[model samples]
Target: MKGFIIYFLLSSITGNPLMAFLGVIIIYSLIDRFYLGFLPDFTRIFRRNRQMKNSLKELQVNPQNASATFSIGILYFEKKKYEEALKYLEHPKLKDNETANFYYYMGMTLMKLKRSDEGKDYIMKALEVNPRIGYGLPYIALIDHEMEKYAPDRHIINDLEEKIEKFANTENLYKLGRLYKKLGNKEKAKNLFSKAMVEYSYCPKGIRRIHRKWAILSRVYKIV
Candidate 1:
């Protein structure tokens, strides 16, 4: 009713339907920008960029600071600066850390850099360190699929399927759907996408915040 009233008033004042429609669109976009967050978080991006700059300064102060090096590399990775991320992540000091997270991030950075085989090796090492790395299975499946090594390591697929059954979250469903789609299991993929859509629709708004990216991807898959 409010939208109709606004449109009617705009149309009356402008004496042009298209202009009134455009005005309504602009108003809705503003509302979405401020309240709905359908757009990227510019504030978060700006803060991250600031952190990257600070990390660079910290690195200059202590060039051999493993923590600082890893921090800068992680920030670069999050910003999709894969090559720059590798420059820091590949620092010899990071190898001394030897944690699952270190290996996972290195693998992800390598994958983004198109070093798929090396990425796969690192991801496998990460899994070997801790099979329950929450984000590991999807990447493993993705890398294997990219390498066309279907079922090369059945354990990863089995592990992912098990996790999906255990968690049954929207994001997990969407990830599995993507894996199935990549492997040419269209019917299974379609079913998983449909399931993810239903889960997204019923999920609480606050919880949906975390699943937002997956929800968007699911919608795109449906369209395709």
Candidate 2:
């Protein structure tokens, strides 16, 4: 309603409906980027690419540095260029330094590329390195992949519950709450959403800032 009013006023003043609509979109997008956190950041791709270039420069100075190569891979992954991400992540130098994150990222990228068997292996390796790695994201990804294959509802619920019980955080709690909502478990969803807010409050300031959007969404979902 507010957006329509703004659009109408802009069109009435400018006498150009298309230009006014575009203006409204730009204005709304800018506001959302800075304050609302509801819209995707369209400029993120350019910024990530710039970081990737800097990482490439680092490689020029030290050809054997896996850190630069890994950084470039992570940047590509952030931009959803999974194939390119896989290329750099799979670089021979990176193998010698395979941490839990390395395995998880490689596995997740492979899953995105439709290589599930190989992906699962790497994800399992990530778990072997650290079960609590990535705040339970590796386990959640496995569950998510299972869901894609029509895993039973009980199976998914068990998996999500186990992960949450092991380590509840804003990301997984809100995500599970959304899944519960989708499954028509309104009471369970609301409880999880409310718990997400409670858990968020206890997080360190830096982590809370990172997950602020999830906390806000949890509040909205709990109320609705």
Candidate 3:
């Protein structure tokens, strides 16, 4: 997927159809061999970790680029390297809205690692720096959702639904559908899920997952 995204980006910049096609084939082959064949999930995670390590090395050589530092931090967080993410993201020299996003993701990583107090501090700092950062709200909602012990809240779910609707991306739509289902709004869930199915059908896994979800909803709600 990453290779395909990179290829597509290059193709967009260079206007080369053959290169884009080659990129698709390369990504497909890699996905088939690794994800569909025999590579363990941990192996994929390790590869990503190594990639982040290399990126961090590059960032160290050019510490003035905030984008590189933030990207490296994001990659670290994605690999669950919370301490490393914090080390880079908490650099006092880094100060900007992008750095605020780093703090938000760091807080989310710490929260996932079960350090709520430290996580809250970082999240508060994120909001202090950029109150309108979209990512921070979702993290807060997640924390609230977790603390509520999985008991669904219509109000919170509704707010998320509104945000997802306003944003209207494939991921946000899928999440909105799930949240609506959790909140017992089956009709709304089905509609959002159908929209997501249409929007994300290019990706096989996403299509399959959405179809399975719709099948279950169909049984439960008689949704056509």
Could you say which candidate leads in TM-score?
1
Q: How many times do residue backbones clash in model 3?
A: 0
lDDT of 3: 0.63
Q: When superposed on Cα atoms, how far off is each prediction in RMSD?
A: 4.3, 4.6, 11.4
lDDT of 1 by residue, 1-224 (tens): 88888899999999999999999988977765654557677788999989888888988898887888998888888888899889888989887877888888888888777777888787778878987665535353543445366536667656546655655677878877887787787887888888888888888876766666677787788667
TM-score of each: 0.75, 0.69, 0.46
Over 4 Å off, model 1: 1-38, 136-147, 150-156
List the pairs of residues colliding in candidate 3.
Answer: none
Which 10 consecutive residues of model 2 have the lowest summed lDDT? 143-152
Comparing 1 with 3 on TM-score, the higher-scoring candidate is 1
Q: CA lDDT of 43 in candidate 3?
A: 68
Candidate 3 is scored at a TM of 0.46
Judging by lDDT against the true structure, name the best candidate.
2
The residue-by-residue lDDT of candidate 3 on 141-172, one tens digit each, is 45344444546566755564454455454555
